[model samples]
Target: MPKKAKAHASRQITLSELVTIQAGYPFRGSIQENPDGDVKAVQPRDISDLGELSADKLITTNLTGKRKADWLQQGDILFISKGIRHFACYVPEDMPETTLAPSLFLLRVKPEYQGQLNPEFLTWQINQAPVQRYFDNSAEGSRQLNIRKPILAAAPIAVPDIETQNTIARLYAASLRENALLHRLIHNRQQQLNAIANDLISHS
Candidate 1:
């Protein structure tokens, strides 16, 4: 008979063993602007429901020089840490190039050397509930659980074949497009309703 599958692999990798990021940046909301074009700031609320660096709420600040420069960009992934209790999250959508303002760990996928990991899949994996629990277990501080890059990378992870990873990434990309479409539809409907209400009030 063929060799049966083992109950478990003799070895397993952890999260902290994945990539390289020492710690996450925690951008507070207080530093965030209230949505005027003149200000410059970012906050967790700026993270769209779809997990992306959504449109930002600008705030008053003299944040210039190098600080004024290194903003966010499209296709960049960021990890949200701090202030929140014990959960791992990411900005799912791509922001305009040069819009950095969140306390998030900017993730750059060196595609040339990710082994068998699709960066998109990894994004989902990290934000996964089970994986979040791993971080929770390793949390150090009292209120905010801090996990350094080493520990974050050492977390256990099992990746499938590259073909499979690519397949998952394709699906994920499709889903993201769908989500954006849905959002646009909703927004258009809301606009229509508001216009109708305004007309009725004005005509009355």
Candidate 2:
């Protein structure tokens, strides 16, 4: 309807067409945390509601299996497969030697589509209202909803031109930073107010 809305490329494609999706490392039993562990483990809690991954909070664990670990790479997308919030997060370039828990699905752009598709754009698209609605509707389970790989692979993504995608992704990232700053400011102001009130009460 709007001019800007029509600006995006009309080529709507399924997610599977552009990327290879793989479930995260299938570590048996609970991951044992080690103070001097070799690798960082990304759990669902490590991802923020705004779709940003908090790398610092990731627990370090000594990976134990004989199988080679599928280490997370730059430009990979992490999708929360099981949870009430099925959002996708972009892995930044400066990530630690990390592997995620099985609760996430790792998406890497296929070799052919590498330059054509931007990982940040894909993450933003998957977390968009329309795509999230698709996941919400398709998710199974009464208490804790789980998004199947098929449902995620079949999710429709509007593939705009590279320029548009990059612009959108950058803007989304900037917005997330602004949101975080605002929340921090609010929290600090609340703390200041509490301190002032406590001081006044003590003096009274």
Candidate 3:
């Protein structure tokens, strides 16, 4: 591999290799709602948390069956099939033991490929420049762009070697965490500085 490749190049694997299959998000009106039940549906805004799904992200489902629930698993990945093209992020962690929400496609990987693709890495890649471009190109609607399975599967994937992919995944995950921590730290320091200024002003 070239030198720059080490920085950004990946093995480029087929979508079929690392993915099991795709599930479409149900239309908002199509999701069966229960008046007495409590389920917090996840929308595009819920894809953050370093690409991890939060417990509150689970939405209510009127569908009564085990198979539909099986679509979400501990390590299964959630991808936004609609909305902003570049907003196609993945859920990094396990799905909460709750009803899976609609408007997002769920991609469950087999146990054999667990370590091959990290949810965080895949999420970052999906939101990256190249893949985002594919989504932009594939989107066919005026309001919210719609991304089909073919578009996702055929999107050029620059999957580097396993080792490199692992590194990239780790780096991606760590950077987000560190950035969040840094932001909090900065906020706290700012508050302290403001307090000190307030004391000086009061004394003066």
Off by over 4 Å in 2: 1-6, 94-96
Badly placed stretches (over 4 Å) of model 3 are 1-10, 24-40, 49-67, 88-93, 111-115, 186-204
lDDT of 1 by residue, 52-91 (tens): 4445443444343334344444434556555453333344
The whole-model lDDT of each prediction reads 0.55, 0.89, 0.63
Better of 1 and 3 by TM-score: 3
Residue 63 displacement in candidate 2 (angstroms): 1.3
State the RMSD for candidate 2.
Answer: 2.0
Tens-digit per-residue lDDT, 11-105, candidate 2: 99999999999998888878889989989889899899999888878888987766677788899999999978898999987565799888999
Q: Which candidate is the best by lDDT?
A: 2
lDDT for each residue of candidate 3 in 1-204, tens digit (9 for 90 to 100): 545533655577655567765664344465665655544445556666345444464456554434545335555566777676335445544445344445676666557777776655666677778877778877878897777777777777666667776777788778877977998899999999999999999999
Worst 10 residues of 3 by lDDT: 63-72
Question: In model 1, which regions exceed 4 Å deviation?
Answer: 1-12, 24-43, 55-76, 85-102, 108-112, 135-151
| lDDT of model 1 at position 115 | 63
Clash pairs, candidate 2, are none
